[model samples]
Target: MAYDPNNIFAKILRGEVPSKKVHEDEHTLAFHDINPLTPSHILVIPKGPYVSFDDFSEKASDAEIAAFTRAIGKVARDHGLAGDGYRILANIGENAHQEVPHLHVHIFGGKRLGRMLPKE
Candidate 1:
C-alpha cells in the first residue's frame, strides 16, 4: 500500500491535533504518547509522512533516517535516560499493533522497564 493522507500521525504532524511535544528537528518530531507504556514515554515520528518502517525506503531519504535516529538518541539522553537504559520501538503493519498508520519510534524509560513489553 501507498502512503495515505488520512494517517493519524500525518494529522499530528500537520498540527491538526494536540500533542505533548518533546523534540523537533527539520526531519522529525518527538511527542509524548497519550497512552504511555512507561514512566516517560514519547513518540519520535518522521515529518515525511511515512506509513511504517517499510515505507521508510520510499518516503525517507538517508538524511531523514539519520535525523530520525539522532532524534531518538537525543530524546533518550536529554531526558536523563542514557545511563538507566531505554527502549526504542517502531511498530509496523496491523499485525505489529500499529494503531496509527504512520512511522514512529517509541522512547520509553525513567524507570526500570520490566519484561520490556506489555502482556498480550
Candidate 2:
C-alpha cells in the first residue's frame, strides 16, 4: 500500500494535529494514546511515511529502525512501565484492523495484562 501523507499519524508528525507527545528524536516520535487501553498506553512511530511494520522494516534506514526501536523502549522506561513489563504490538493490514495507515507500535502497560488473546 502506498503511504498517505494525509493520514492521522502523518498529520501528527507534521504538527497539523495535536498529540500528547512523550518523546521525540530525529527518527522517531512517542506519544500518549488518546483512547488508552491501559494506564500507560503509548504509541511509537517512525518519522518517515511508512504504511505498516512490513513497509517500515523493508524500507526504513538502519538508523531509523534503531531509533524507532529504542524510542519504544525509552518510552516504556520513562513511563515507569519497565519494572512491571509491557506489551508492544502493531496491527498490520486490514485483517489486523489497523486504524491508521502509518506504521505505529502500541505500548501497553501499568497493570498486569492478561493473555494477549483469548484461546481459540
RMSD of each: 2.1, 0.8
Tell me how candidate 2 scores on lDDT: 0.94
Q: Compare the candidates by TM-score and give the number of the best one.
A: 2
Residue range 1-120, candidate 2, lDDT tens digits: 678899999999999999999999999999999999999999999999999988898999999999999999899999999998999999998898888899999999999999988999
Let me know the TM-score candidate 2 reaches against the reference structure. 0.97
On lDDT, the leading prediction is 2
How well is each residue in 1-120 modelled by candidate 1, as lDDT tens digits?
457887777888888988889999999999999999788999998898688887887768999999998999999999998998998888788778877777888988988877756799
User: Model 2 off-target regions past 4 Å?
Assistant: none
Candidate 1 ranges beyond 4 A from true positions: 117-120
Per-candidate TM-score against the hidden true structure: 0.89, 0.97
Give the range where candidate 2 is weakest over 10 consecutive residues by summed lDDT. 1-10
Q: For candidate 1, give the lDDT of residue 13.
A: 82
